[model samples]
Target chain A: MKIGIFFCLKVWNMNAKIAIQGIKGSFHHQVAQEYYYQNVEVDECLSFEELIDSLMSGKSDQAVMAIENSIAGPIIPNYALIDKNNLHIIGEHYLDIHQNFMALKGQKIEDILEVHSHPMALLQCMEFLKKYPNIKLVEDKDTAETARRIHQNQLKGIAAIASKTASEMYDLVILAPEIQTINNNMTRFVIINKADNFVSKNEINRASIKFELDHKRGSLAAVLNVMSDCKLNLTKIQSLPKIETPWKYSFFVDVTFEKYEDYAKAKALLTIMAEYFKVLGEYKNTKP
Target chain B: MKIGIFFCLKVWNMNAKIAIQGIKGSFHHQVAQEYYYQNVEVDECLSFEELIDSLMSGKSDQAVMAIENSIAGPIIPNYALIDKNNLHIIGEHYLDIHQNFMALKGQKIEDILEVHSHPMALLQCMEFLKKYPNIKLVEDKDTAETARRIHQNQLKGIAAIASKTASEMYDLVILAPEIQTINNNMTRFVIINKADNFVSKNEINRASIKFELDHKRGSLAAVLNVMSDCKLNLTKIQSLPKIETPWKYSFFVDVTFEKYEDYAKAKALLTIMAEYFKVLGEYKNTKP
Candidate 1:
C-alpha cells in the first residue's frame, strides 16, 4: 500500500489491484469485498492458475487464495500452487462459512428430494444429509451457484446448500436453515503479493517452510528430530506430490520457533537447518 | 478360515454387515468396493449419518468414511462425525479419484455452455472451467446422475465432471478425460468398528484424540505446550465447533504418541490434563 500510494501521489500510475478466482457471488468474491472497498478494481481470474499467473506476470498487484475451510482441512492443491508459483504469503484472514439449505420459493423442506452443495458443504453437513437419505448428495462448484440451479431448474423436489445471501439472490426459501453440521465453521484465506508484505515487527516466532529430501528411509524422521532438538513446536505438516521431481514428495511445515530464542536466533537455526533441507518461505503468524 | 469352516460345519450364522454412503457410481461406493466382498455384506446408506448410525447400533459390522482427498485436503465434517460417534478406527485405505469430463454423445467441448459436477470435482477442474467463463457451473448431487441428465435432456451445451465408470454407466462421451486439475489424486477412507481394536502386538506409536478446552485466552497455546513437553509429535490439529457447549472449542489431534509407552502412560497424561480439558477418546491411528 505504501508503494502504491507513492506511485499514486508522485506519478498517478498505480492502483492496488486484488486478484481473485470465480465470478460474482462466489466466496472468493465475498472475501475480496470484505477487504477491498466496493468498486475496487479486481482482476477476476477464472482459476487459481490464472490468478497465480497474473500475480507472477505483474498483471495483478496481489492475489487472495482460500487456504482452508472449516469443512476441509486445507485446499491441498492451492498450497502446492502457491509453493510451486513461488508466491509470498503476506497476510491471512478468516471468513465465517454459514451454509443454508435452499430451495425455490414456496417449496417446503419435505418437497425436496435431493440436496446440492459444494462437496465440502455436503461433507460438512454429512449428518444433516443423513436425515434425508432418499435425497441424494451432490457436489457443485460454488455454494451460491447451487442456489441458482434450484431456481433455474424450477424443480420443487430439489434444494441447495448455500449462503443466506444466495437464498435472497435467487428468491429461494431456506429449506433447512443453517444445515452445515458444525456451527462454528470458518475458512482461512491468505493474501499473497510478489513484493514483501511479510517481515512483521510483531513476528511471534511463526515460520512456513517447504522441503524435499532424497526419498529414503528415515529421511522425514531425521528432519523432524532436528526441530524437536530445538524444542520448536510443529503446528502443521501437509505433503504435496513432487511436481518437479516425479514420484517424489514435498512436505510443508508450519512451526513456531520458540519466542525465547529471539528472531535472530530463530533465523540462525532455520538458516543452518536449510543446509540439509529446502526452506520454502517464512512469514510472521498473523493470527490474532 | 479355520473358524469360518468350523462355524459352517456347526451351524449357519449371520455374516458381517458393512454400511456406506452413496449409490452405485459414486466415489464412496467405489471406495467401499475395496472392502465389500466375501464376509462383508455391504449395505448402502443414503447419507454419511446412516453409515455412522449403523456402526453405532451394531446394525453394521463396520462403516466406511472418506476422511480426505488428495486434490482436496481432509473431509472436515467426516472428522466431526467420527469424533461424535463412539467408533474405533480399525484400518485405513486410499482410493485414487479419477474425474472424467463427460457430455452427451456427439457433443463437442466448444459446445459446452454449462458444466455440472459434485462441488469438489468442480473445484478441482477450476483451472479448466476458467476458459469457459461464460459457461454456467451447475452444482448437482450425483456426478453420474448429472451425466444421466445430460443424456436424457440432450443438452448439447451441457457437460458433467464425472467418473469414467459413470460415463460408461450412462453411455456418454468423454469430452475431456482425467479432467481434474491434478493427477495422482486420491482419497483416504477409514473403517470404523464399534469395538476397541486395540491390540497387544504391532507398533502402537499412533493415537487419535479429541478434546474440549475452556474457551479462554491461550487455551490452544497451553495445550500445544503440554503436548510439546510430552515429546508427542503433533501431525494434524483441526477445530470442530462445540455446538453443544456455547463458546467452548473442541479439537481433533493426530499424533505420534511414542508407541513404546503403555496405554496408561498416554491416558495418564490426558487424565492429569483433564481439569482444563475434555478427553473425548483415544484410538489407534490408522494412517501409519
Candidate 2:
C-alpha cells in the first residue's frame, strides 16, 4: 500500500524539491539533508510562512518544518499555519539538536563579553551561560548567521552559540561544546505537502490528528473514552485556541496502536464526534 | 474565604512590588498596572528568568508573565519555569495587545525599508506587512526598546511594531494602528508567586494543575474520565517534557466546574491517580 501511494504521488511530479527555513548549516538544513538526499537542492526560506508558500506555489515538493522541540516545546503558530493553508503532514523526523559555543581563534571564555545566537539557542544554553557572569547574552536572527557574521567581521570579545557544523563552516573555534542545558535535546520535524498523502503501511503504529469538539461538558473526555475503547493509546495532546472563534480550542493529538483496525475504529468514531476532524499523517512511531 | 486568604497574604507584606519583563510602557507593565494597583511599584527585568528570580528573592510580591496569546499561542518555557521554580498561579489578567506600526515623524509605510519588533509581535502583524514587499522584518530583543531606539536615533526608513502606548511614550508617530492580523488580539497573563496562595473560595470555579501520569496504555484517558465524571470541563491542556527524564512527559491542565464540590472530588481523584500531582492554583474563571 505504501509503494502504491508513492507511485501515484510520483506520477504528478518528476523532481522532488525540499524547502527549509534557513541557509546551509542551519538545523532545518541539516534535517532536510538527512531526511532527503544530501545532493537534493533545498529552497531556503526566510520565515516559516515563506517555507509553506514555497510548497503551495509548487516550488518545492515537500517542506520540512520543526513542529516541536524537546526543550522549547511546540511551535504553536506553525500548527495554525498548517491548518489555515490546508497542508498535510506526510512524515515526521526527530533530529538531535546540539549547540556549541564558538568564538574567534585564541579567544577564551573570559575574553568574550557578548555572546549572540537565536533566542531559543540562548535560552537552551542558559545553564552553561550562568557560570559566566561577565558575558552578556544577545538574541540574533539566526544561530548560523550569527556565526557567519562573527567570522566575517573578525570581532573580538564576541561569541556565538550554534551548531558544531556552523562553527566549522565559519572557521570559528568551539569555545564550549554541547552548551545546551540538556544532553538529549531533540526537535520533531514534520514533512508536509499540499494534500492528504497517507500510506497504510503494516508498521504504521502512530497517527497525527487534529479535531474540534462541541463546547460542552465532557466533550473532550468523550473523545478520549472513544480512543480508549478502540484500544488506541494517546501519546501526546496539545490544545490551540481557534483564531476565528475567540476562546474555543482545537486539539492536536497523536495516538499509537498495535493493531490497525483499532485505530480505524477510533478514527471513525472521532470523525462523527468531532467538528473538524483531520488525520494529519499516519507514520511510524519514532519516539520512545 | 478568598478575603480571609487575602488578609493573611497582605499582612505579610505591606507594599506590593510587581515584577515585569520589560521597562515602563511595555505591555507587561500595562498589565501589571491594571492587575495590581496603578500606583504599584514595578520591578523591571531584562528577561523572564530575571522576573522569576525577582520573585524567588522576595524582591517583588508577585510577577506578571504572559502565558498565552490569542495569536502567538502559549509561551512554552514559561510553563516549565513555573513548574521548576515552584511558583503558583495566583491570578490571571487578559490584556488587549494592540501592535501599532510606528516611525519617525512624517514617514509613511512606503518609506519604511526595515521594520523591527519582538519576534512574537512581528508574527502577529504578518498579514498587514504582506502589503509592503520592500519592507524587511527584523526581530529585536524588546518591542518598546525598539521603539525607543528608533525614536532616539531619529532613524529614517525604519519603523517599529509595538504597543500604542510605546509609540506615545517614545514620541513616535503611529503609521498604522492595530496592524496585528486579528482585531481581537489579547494576551492572557498569569500572576505568579513563589508560595501556594490558593484560597479555595466559594466562587472558585477554575483551577490550574500539573501532574504526571503512569506511562501505561490508558492512564491519561482514565484521569480525564474521572474529571468528566466529576462534572469538570477541561479548558486547556499542555504537555511538557520532564527535565530529568528524557522520554517522560508531565501534563498541565486547566479545568472549570460549576460547583466547587465537583472540582474537589476531581482534584482528590487526580491526586490519588496521578504521580507527582500538584495544584498550581485555584482561582475564578475570568475569561468569557
Candidate 3:
C-alpha cells in the first residue's frame, strides 16, 4: 500500500534525483523532500564525500547539504569540500530540528537502559537525558540507523534519539518527544547543483563569496570597507585556515544587497582587492 | 621517581591548580601541562562544562580550553561556553597535536582488528586508517581513557589512536607514531581564569570581543571600519546564532594591534555603535 502511494508520487515528479547524506527518514532525507518535490528520487549517500560524488558524477541532479546548525555552528570541513568540489549553491534552507527519543513498543521510559544517536544529536538532547541517570548515552553513526537497529534487534532496554519519521519508519514508539534542550533549534542547509544556471530574477538579495588575502594588516578590513561603500550588507563572515599555509586564512563572506548593481560593484572591487576570490552563489535571501 | 620530580616541581610552582577536560593523559591534560608550570595540581574534569565549573567553584585557579584546531576548525561550543559562563580568557597557547596509534607491546599493525579514539582524533587519522580496512574505528569518550581501558581489560587485537603521553601512562607501545593525516596539525587553546586580573606587560597585542548589532544592514561593516580606523588587524571572526532570537546573529572577533590605546579607541566606539558588546579578553599576542 505504501509502495503504491510512493509510485503515484514518483510518477508525478519523474527523474528528479536529489542526493543527501543519510538513509530514509533521516534529517537530510526530510530536507530533500521538503526542499524539492515530495516524491523526488532520493539518492542516499553514506557520507558527505559520496553525496558530492553523486552530484559530480551525474548520478544526482542536485544535493542538499547541511551547512550549519544553530547549536553546533558551521560544519567547517563541508565548506572546504564545497569549495574544492566547485559545486554551485543554488539555494538555502532552514530546518527546524526536533529530536525525539524513541524505543520499542510496550517499553516505558524506565525500561530504557541505554540510548544511542549521532554525537551531535546526543549533545543537543544532553540536558533532558541527564534526568535519566540510569540511561547511558552512546554515540552511533546515524540516528535513523540507530532506530532501525533497535527495531530489528528487538532491544528491550535500548532507545534511540531520532526524528519522528524514523520512529514511524522503524515501527517504534516515541518515548519522549522534542528532547533537544533548545526547543526552537534549527539547522541551515545549502542546495548545490553541478551547473551554475541560476538566473537572477532581480530578487537575488544574498550571495556567498570566498577569497584569500595576503598577510598584510588591514586586508580584510579594507574588503569589508569596500563592501560597505558599495552598499552591500555583510550578513556572515567565516575564516577558514588554509591547509598548507600555517597561519594564513581564507575568508568566506555572505552578503546581501538592495540592488543587484550594488552587489556587482562590491564584487568588482573585491576582485581587484582580494588575491583570489570566487562567488560561491547568489540566491534570493530566504531569511530576513 | 616520577613522584619525586613532581613534588620538586610543585614546590617550585606552588598554589597553581589547573583544570582540564579529560583524564591525566588526554589532549586537555597535555595542554594544561604544557601551558602551565609542570607538576602544578591538575584537576581533571569529565567535560568542558565540568572544567569550567571547577574554575568557578574555586577548585582550580585556571583552566586550559581548546579553542580551535587546524584540521577540525574551531570548537565552537567551547567559545559559547566560555562566553556564557562569564569566564575571562587570560592567555592563549598553541600546541602541536601529534596523534599516535598504539597497542599492546607485542601487537603488530596487522594484528589489530579494532581501533578506538575520540571522534575528532579518528577524523584526523582517517587517511592513515583507510590503509587498514579490516580495522573497525570506534569512537570513545576520551582517547586517553580508551587507552587506559584497553590496558586494564587486557584487550588484544585492539589499538587506540592517542598521544604519546597516553601510551606511557597506560603502559602501551606506540605501533605507529604521528598517524594524523596532517603532520603539522595544531590546536589553539585559550588559558581562562575566573578573575579578570591579567595586567598587560607592555606587550598586549590581541583582544577578543563579542558584540551584537541591531538588525540594521551595515552595522557589522561599520564596526569593521572602526577597527580599521584604529589600526586593529582582524585575525578571526565567528558568528554565533542568538538562541532566543531566530535569525539574528552575534559576532565574536579577535583583533590584534600594535598600540593598546588604538584597541581602546576601537572598543570605545564599538560600545556605542553596537547594541550589546563585551570585551572577552585582552592579552599579549602569542601567535607569532
Best by TM-score: 2
lDDT by residue for model 1 over A150-207, one digit each (tens)? 7877868888888777788788888677777777677777778776544453443566
User: How would the docking of model 1 be graded?
Assistant: incorrect
Query: What is the per-residue lDDT of model 1 for residues B1-288, given as tens digits with 9 covering 90 to 100?
Result: 323432442354346666876545667667666644433456766557667877788787777787766665566667767765767765566777788888988888888888887666787677678777787887655576678777778778889998887788788999888867677677667767676533232545556677765534344455556565566766555555455332234567666665545444545676665443333334445442
Clashing pairs for model 2 are: none
Give the C-alpha miss distance for residue A179 in model 2, angstroms: 0.6
DockQ of 3: 0.52
Candidate numbers, best lDDT first, in rank order = 2, 3, 1
Model 1 stretches astray by more than 4 angstroms: A1-15, A21-27, A43-59, A69-73, A97-138, A145-183, A197-207, A211-261, A274-288, B1-15, B25-33, B36-41, B57-59, B69-71, B95-186, B197-288
DockQ by candidate, in order: 0.18, 0.65, 0.52
**Cα RMSD, each candidate:** 6.2, 2.4, 4.8
Would you list the clashing residue pairs of candidate 3? Answer: none
Tens digit of lDDT per residue, candidate 2, span B20-110?
9887878999998776656668898878998999999999988999998877778889998988888888878898888999999999888
Q: Which ten residues in a row have the lowest lDDT in candidate 2 chain A?
A: A5-14
- Please rank every candidate by DockQ, starting with the best: 2, 3, 1
List residue ranges in candidate 3 displaced over 4 A: A1-13, A56-59, A198-203, B1-16, B132-134, B200-203
Model 3 chain A: which ten-residue window has the lowest total lDDT?
A1-10
lDDT of 1 at A103: 85
Which is the winner by DockQ between candidate 2 and candidate 3?
2
Docking quality (DockQ) of candidate 2: 0.65
